[model samples]
Target: LLEYLEKDSFTKDEILAIKTEDAGLTEHLEAIKQAYGFGYDSISELIEELEGYLKSLNERLDYYLNIDFDGRSVVGDDPDNLDDRDYGDNNVMPKNGSIHGTHVSGIIAAVRNNGLGSNGAANNVKIMAIRNTPNGDEYDKDVALGVYYAVDNGAKIINMSFGKSFSPHSDWVRDAIAYAAKKDVLIVAAAGNDSKNTDEGQYYPNDQIGVGEEVGDTFLKVGATTYDYGSGIISGFSNYGKSSVDVFAPGSRIYATVPDGKYRFLQGTSMASPLVAGIAALVLSQYPKLSAAELKQILMNSGLPVVKKVSLGDDAVVPFSELSKSGRLVNAYNALIMASKISR
Candidate 1:
């Protein structure tokens, strides 16, 4: 808020008046006082600490508000039009040359044993790039159409590694998910990297309109996990909830291919989501008769259980089982075995 005022050239007295009159700021400052009472020995010191925190948020908001890149002209479509689906061309590459999509693709199906970077989660798979999400928030129309394109183009499993806090046109994406469900296509999505409980504040493009009320049975929301299977197994930044996130998967320090024919290590629920998507693809490949619903069930039910306490956002400790609905970390071998039994 302070940064925005400075950006718009507000005077000192104006800023002071706005701060003094802002009810939301007063409520937030009071909440902060309650959350960290007397930590700084007095109210003045606490106010000073809170001012720093507000400055951090101000800077972040200003950064996002000032991004110069515009990707709308590349696709050449009316972003507000839900019916304008025949817009994007064959070019699926990132506008800014970001390697995020490439990294996720490699994590799902990089070629194995050719003396390259590393083997992907699946052996044989075909990739379809939608390229809708950009550096920041994506349009709802684009996301909805992307799902439609994938399902229509013979994509049996769709991997979505992007999410945002708000979705003004959530129904469009929700309908697209339902369309995928009708076609027996499974969707694997990241639960976001906010480290907050999704049940309390949702990440968009989810299967649920409200918590626990699922729109489709084929959608899987995956959370990130660390290599450590101990009390701190949950990734420090991975969003979680027993009612929102479906499963956990290894995401921290993941090695995969990047653009320009290079490879690197990265981490997020983005990586974790594709790992599960790759597993789903592998299971479907081996058990061709399995339906999308069955495949989702197999992945969820076959994972290795983690029943210990896990450290979540900030310093809150909760049972690992409370992190995701399945209370398990995705296991490829176990999923394949479970698929075999179900197929038989």
Candidate 2:
């Protein structure tokens, strides 16, 4: 509240009036607090309560408000780019109304600061949209080609915002991930959207390459985050893994581009991956010489930690430290701080 007041135009008198109007404001604030923390008794009850709360909040919150970027027409229907590029069937073209890709694209680089939409985390970036992911599970060939295509076309960072729990030829995708790692291109992926721990064989395409105590430095699988920090450890439905999922970001109720030149609120690790990708883009943009491994270290090392203990599949609040590889949430502010030191 103090932070909000300092940044916004809320004068002393206006704030006084608000405080006066809501006699129980402090009481309510203390209850839900930082993350709308709840003390439910059962998982079903928790889901029931969270679903309604999230749905209602989605109607009002602009999930993409934080990232700085503007929308562009790469293929399907960007009015600004009048026939700039053909979105052929052979090549997965950008859908004018596909909200998911548009949102992810906006997060990566949507024409920074044009006085239109929000600015992307990175100031300088050239987003190459390879539309391989469809409504359902994506094909292994498509995903493989997507990674190779990005590498061949000079794409330093590839943001894969889609995945599935089942794949016929899983090795193909794994090899694609490996290929990206070998080529020195950073591949940030979404740890599926199941809200369960992927370490349990539940998380397909799971990043358990090294297993034991150390994970390979090539891939960074991310879980989605909600608005608050405390009891809101992970999204109500985000899959968690002790060592698989690297970190978390705001994926609760993201506001981003949609098909038909419109915008709306959508949820998934799909949304979170782009958020991280955009931040990585910013880091690379500032220090263009940083390798993919260096970039990943910067991200993990600079993230913000959640102090409050919270539950993972139940109401038993465990220390935030017990969650993922890094007990911290993705913090762009901290990332820049660390990146500056590294750049020097």
Candidate 3:
């Protein structure tokens, strides 16, 4: 980084080119400027600031990785205790300025026809913000409690766009799923971004007990799909399974909201889950009497069928139908039509 920055001077275009090379460096430079003044008087000053910033960033990263930095000590509750709901505050907003939840929320219910960013999938949707995820892996107890809170507070459709590979106490989550099912609430979860078959693996917060065994019919697992309708339709990063994942949804390069009242394009099953959730919300709004299980089935069965073989990852290809249980891409129009027919 020093070698790249070592120069007599830098033009605006050259600075922009350097910033484009790394997102972290760009943010660091912006932060430095915000702390100090706007423009640096000399290249040496800029280089000095960047060197210190890089050193601090590396040290912080090393500490985070090598040390067992536990933030739960401040929360004052044991992670093992599911009944200990006395911790946490009412701040359901994103912590540490994370835009993941913001992007997911916008994908579902951003204002329509306002010329702000883009039109969301659903119009008449009431979003309930649940801040359970931190910077890294979330706790199983928090996952359970978040679901319970959503269900109890009249959340008809819950979109969990986050997942981890390991969950020591997944039973808590599964029990929450059963509770949501009994209350007739639909859960839409991301299939994960691991680029592996979930049938042969496990993703946390899933409703499945085994490959073919599911706890309830209200759970829908969604895989990520690209805008391509051809062989490369399936996103290479998406996790898939014939029995695990329920459907595919557009996730690649999805434009939505970000932190600090901004908008940007992001890609993942995280983006896909909320898109599916929005579609589910649209269906449910029109047909309020439909059960969550029926809603799940309608979404799975009414998606757009893909007849072509698609790329999974690493030059590997499989029939699109084999990737997920439904073997179809979630379509809002088709879902609404199916819901109307079912309502009839």
Candidate 4:
């Protein structure tokens, strides 16, 4: 669990200080404390339980880091070959307590005003789960197919919150993106988590098919920003580029849903992408006639510009204008107002 928490971006001290309000966890901890107070046999039982948990976590870590590990045999498809498309099961829910996708989905369209957990950005949007990303890295073929699947299934807006450094079959993914654009389906993608500038680096699934030009106008690339609007506005881990990233949105310490009907705080450009997607969904809900390109334009043009100088990385301070193409932070209210005016 500690390893899992660390992988989920929790620090060591943060993990140690984590206090669960869950009745089961509280009860288990209390029982363990009582066992320590009782006798050596009771303490031994607690040690055994902790050892078992640690062993399981170690095994999970081994599998995650093992390059020779091949779980693809279960899917019965060639990951290298793009032609073999018909593979994998319908179990789209997070496998083995993986809540990254769930968190992103909840940020976009979790149930609102239900008196349950946190409210999502868009209330009436239906989240279509696409299990493309695995534990280690995402396959290019899976991403392309995920886009095609969403587009063919009548999805108006697609939120892709995952990205990688390399894409072997980028053409296939670009073709799929073009297909979605042709169908007027809007795609919102995360710029990346790497602190590097995407304009100088290669991030896959971008609208730019070649050097210095974009193939479509429907695709919007988003970078992460914090709620604080000042020198520390942009997230330290968020990728940025004046030519690549389109806009910024809240991604730092964002509280959202996890697996098993729970919620947690996660931070990344992954969180930021879904936020813009949610705003796009809200605009679409209000103005259904808006095309994908128009929606993208509305989002880019209707954001709140951050004029303050912000830290790009360690000791490097630059104006927010140089960070992204729009030089603006995404504003849902402003986007809605712009959509209303455009609809008129």
Per-model TM-score on C-alpha atoms: 0.79, 0.70, 0.81, 0.80
Off by over 4 Å in 1: 1-76
Per-residue accuracy of model 1 over 67-155 as CA lDDT, tens digit each: 66455667677777798766767787756535678889999999988899988889889999888875554778889999998999999
lDDT for each residue of candidate 2 in 1-344, tens digit (9 for 90 to 100): 44534653333344434443454666534443323243333334445546744653453233222123222233343323322334435644644325568878876676666876566667767778777765542455567667777888898888888776666656666776777777888888887777676776545454444344332356787888787666875777676676778888877766666556555556678788888998988888887778888888888779988888876666656776566678678888888778888874
Best by TM-score: 3
Error of 1 at 34 (Å): 31
Question: Model 2 residue 124 lDDT?
Answer: 64
Of the candidates numbered 1 and 2, which has the greater lDDT value?
1
Off by over 4 Å in 2: 1-90, 94-97, 209-216
Cα lDDT tens digits for candidate 3, 145-261: 999999999999999988878888999999999899999999999999899998898988899766857887799999998877899888878999999999999998788998788
Number of colliding residue pairs in each model: 0, 20, 0, 0
> What would the TM-score be for candidate 2 when compared with the true structure?
0.70
Tell me how far the alpha carbon of residue 258 in candidate 1 is from the true structure, in angstroms, after superposition.
Answer: 0.3
RMSD of each: 11.8, 11.2, 8.2, 9.7
lDDT tens per residue, model 4, 1-344: 33434564433344345578878666755664555443223444446545744664465465544577776778798878888977887887654746678889899898998987888899788888778876645677888999999999999999988787777788888888899999999999999888989888888877674347777779999999876779988888899998989999998868799888887666788899999999899899989999999999999999999888999776799999999889999999999999989984
lDDT of 1: 0.83
lDDT of all predictions, in order shown? 0.83, 0.67, 0.84, 0.82
Task: List the candidate 4 regions with Cα displacement exceeding 4 Å.
Answer: 1-69, 209-211
What TM-score does prediction 3 earn?
A: 0.81
